[model samples]
Target: MSELYDLTIVGGGPAGLYAAFYAGMRDMKVKLIEGKEVLGGFLHHYAEKTIWDVGGIPPLRCEQLIERLSAQARTFDPTILLGRRVDTLERLERGAYRLRTDDGQSHDTRTILVAVGRGITEMTKLDIRGADRYELTNLHYTVQNPESYRGKRVLISGGGNSAVDWANELVGIAREVIVVHRRPEFGAMERSVARMLEMADVRTPYVLRELHGSGDAIRAVTIGHADDEEEGTGIERIDVDAVVVSHGYTRSYGDLLAWGLEIGQHGVRVSDQTATNLPGIFAAGDCATYANKVKLIAGAFTDAVLAVNSAMRHIDAEAPGMAYVSSHNEKFREMNKRLKRPL
Candidate 1:
């Protein structure tokens, strides 16, 4: 029989990663399962973007934050599973929970923590046929490296924050930037939109109609008025060295929602203590919703601590309500000694 863990964390985003680390401080056996092959969750989509809101941390690229979080998650050597999509959850006869992944592997845990932030997400790709062929070349759904498009004429599609933000970021880097949006009003901060308008060539009420490319690179594109039904009127062709599409993402919770947990508009409903409707089950991160919840990386960390504490109390009613603060905790004595060793 597989060993039953004290806590099993679903999703390896900020919440799950932090829970794994904090659970170690409580001396609980932990396991974390991530659906994707890598950790970091949705942060991988904006790896090159700068993140500044995390408390006590200086501004750093999202990728650097992911690296730090992943490193911290492994501090206690918790069992980490990657590329496993959890398919079902079942309550065992003894009140323990069984989580079965799509690969048919089962994990037994005394308590389950649902931290699948926004569930499994996939970027919304460009709709134009044959657009994918250029993905390997000049077409980009994500900006992994801003330097890649330096000195190139870049065409961006979408009106959301990501689209506008990327356009603004590329203003001084790219030789020229052109933004095409279906709506006249962009769905980004007013100041950012104003900055983009003052820099990039902003085209409103427009949609990418076609791509002109040879081999694996797009050399030009045709854009049309959003309301042009015939696709023949109000057409304009623009030459470009690269194209960026930021259409947002699609999220799927899989069978997780069918497990009878209380579902809210944002996600699985949980109490202030991070306890879910089900016994021995809790939630955290964007996947867990409560009154006045803050939806940011820092907020996810707070949720992780609360959920881990709740899970600890669920496992052993006599256990302390929360782990001792790191500065005063005895669990890190050996770790601190190791850190002090000469390099």
Candidate 2:
């Protein structure tokens, strides 16, 4: 237990970090809470991937963008508590909040902003029998390091952005790269698809049938045509040194279900201002849902701003609608002064 904060944000993803910065700009005593040891959320999982979607960034790596975001977030001096899972949230008197984490640490705050994007995530597994046995050895889910598969035969399963990205990446690293998907088309960018096929063997309109290997190691895989109506299409066995499945992930809401907030299909239902049904509690990023909501990193930034503004209003009725832009903001100038160490 420590000093009560004006804002205690949950989840330290891109949205959370931005909200913390904005809250600090408003001169509120805020703390950013995170369940994972790492600060960047889902983006950290795809650190190796090149990101071209974020505005004003030209094809930067995910990890590089995270580093920039981390630098910006720390500039605000928001109290950061990592590796702490918020188990429960209690609504205290007069719109304040009390949160208890798994490690028995408690925190109190006047406002709460949930920026948990997609919650805790686990990779979708290949359903083929015994395919999971080789997870640690050959069959892989998340690509931690691309260099590990250097010059080895690789097979990637899935047609999403990750599948196409890995196919493009491993083309230079792996001896041979192959991608298998059940659908006829890929759910990736058109330019990425074009480049990936130039170097990788893509087996779409197909499905993984079996894994051909001995104990704890994969030598090859058996794949079959996805369409049964197409006659004379037999199963094909492709040799590979490693198998990477990128069928997306399974997301769990974690302890959010116990919070007694209004949960919806996409996430917690939020107002136009990003406020939840509960007073002084707000949600942003993928964990919050509103009409015509955008889900990109850029969109999450917009949502975070809205939530922070709503939180400020809730915290103090006389609070202004928004803070001044960074260039003209005195706070930013003051923060810049802090950047230079004392002589």
Candidate 3:
């Protein structure tokens, strides 16, 4: 028989991580499961980008924010299972629930917090044949390090926010930056698109037709007008040090969406208190939606706290409505003693 946890959090993103930390304040046995081997959720897609919206924190790299959130999540020493995707959910007697992962392992919990933001997202890969061979070399789906493209000619393919953002970021770094998009209009912010067009070489209504390479490295690429139906007609080949493909992403909720929950176009429908239709189940972050729900990092943290508190009350109706503020909570007494402070 699997040991039952007080709360099981699916997804290790900002909301899930913060929930784990907040659940510790309620003294609940907790477990967190993340589909990817690493935490941070979709943040890993733009790890090099700077995040300025998180409350009370100065501007910092996204990867650093992930590090801090992951650390705070471990304050209670909850069980963390990585690289496991929850595939099924079964409700048992007495409001107990069993969650099975892709690996066939089961976790029994009295309450659940579904925070799997946007489910398991996969980047849209380049459609060109044999393009994957260059992934390990100069072909990139994401810019993990902007410095790596220093003094090099780089070509970015796509019209989304990421594509335009990367082009702007590489302006001073890359010796030459070229952006090729199939549509004349870009999907990124108007200001950002304008900035990118002003700094880099922007080609509209064009698409990458072929990749020329030797061994595993891409040497150059062939691009042509998107409207031209002929394969080789009206094409131009340009030399490049690196090629970045940021088509977009495909989101999959897997069996989770199949579960009997009030799901809407945005995500699972929850109440102001973060309660789902089913008892002992709640949701947070982008995966959960409510009236006037704010879809931001700070909003995710707010949802996490509400979901944690609701989970605690579901377990014990007599429990407090919410945890005391961290400054006033007894749970932080010993933790505060370890911190250095001025006399």
Candidate 4:
């Protein structure tokens, strides 16, 4: 009995944002629900990272692109509901869908789009005490702006791709870059790991043990050998202005498995049209999977289009396969009025 919407897009990531924009372009009444306090999904986890794969987008920071997506998504002003998690989705007797959230609110929609990527994930924090206090000043799980560390000594913890990648990028900006990892062998790009080894102080098989700081700022850290092979080998103190923990994230299915959708090891099973086997339901972005699927932001853009267009068709069989992009003058006219011209 809730307000009925033409489409209820779940997950406010890139795919959901883009899908909302397109549905609005089609002049459909749409609502965008996001579980996180903010819009952009895991991208927030790497806000400072540069993305180069998105087509025609000049290399820009993750937050920069997220801002662009946020702007583009507002072209038609879809109702954006942030910090609301869709816990379960059920089909109404009349074929419309009803989605219930953890907050005890429900929404009625003509169609649905599942764009939640990898469900909800939280960054793994550094296991050092007093590290939490420095989070506001010197500690960061995701680097929102790389320039913030300019000319300051920085230490990155973790041996994965994110850790090494951040080290590689910060080498030029920070006064000093040091990478501390529990494993000597790194699981990062060979080129990046090689470059970091050459330019940054790469520590091997070391785990963080202590925080040497005062008030809200961290000025140094104590590192220890990670393995019993070198138990009590030694501990070292390194001076640093900031610590970036790229320990990655822990992912779970959450409510997706209980939704009764066909999910696989890769992601939700989706058809060529971005439609799920369930009628009136579709999916896109990293949450949906199919043959020859490209797992990139660029691909997510296409998925949004496909899912929206397919949903449009589901709503009205007479609708075109897709409203032509860059050709529909009528659509572009209104969009252009609100669109920020490239600088």
Candidate 3 local lDDT, residue 161: 96
Ranking by TM-score: 3, 1, 4, 2
Cα lDDT for residue 266, model 2? Answer: 91
Q: Write the per-residue lDDT of candidate 4 for residues 1-343, one digit (tens) a residue.
A: 8999989998888999999888887888999998878989878877877789888889998889999998888878898998778888878877899999879999999999999987777898887765788888888887777899899999899988888878888889999998889998999889988998999998888888788887788888888888745635578888889998888798654465787788877988999998887888899999899999988887888999999999999999999888767555487776567758834
Q: Which pairs of residues clash in candidate 1, taking residues 3 or more apart in a chain or in different chains?
A: none
Better of 2 and 3 by TM-score: 3
Model 1, residue 303: what's the lDDT?
Answer: 98
In the range 1-343, model 3's lDDT, one tens digit per residue, is 5899999999999999999999998999999999889989888888898999998899999999999999999999999999899979998888899999999999999999999998888899999999989999999999999999999999999999999999999999999999999999999999999999899999989999999998889999999999999888889999999999999999776588777989989989999999999898999999898999999888899999999999999999999999999888888888889879722
lDDT by residue (tens digit), candidate 2, 211-253: 8887779988888898854544678988889999998888765
Please name the candidate that would achieve the greatest TM-score relative to the true structure.
3
All models: lDDT?
Answer: 0.92, 0.87, 0.93, 0.86
lDDT of 1 by residue, 40-154 (tens): 9889988998899998889999999999999999999999999898879988878899999889999999999999998888899898888888988999998888888899999
Using lDDT as the measure, what is the rank order of every candidate, best first? 3, 1, 2, 4
Top model number, lDDT: 3
Mind sharing the TM-score for model 2?
0.78
Ten contiguous residues minimizing lDDT sum, candidate 1: 334-343
- Candidate closer to the true structure by TM-score (higher is better), 1 or 2: 1
Off by over 4 Å in 3: 340-343
The stretch of ten residues in a row with the least summed lDDT in candidate 2 is 334-343
Question: Local error of candidate 3 at 233, Å?
Answer: 1.9
lDDT of 4: 0.86
Which prediction has more favorable TM-score, 1 or 4?
Answer: 1
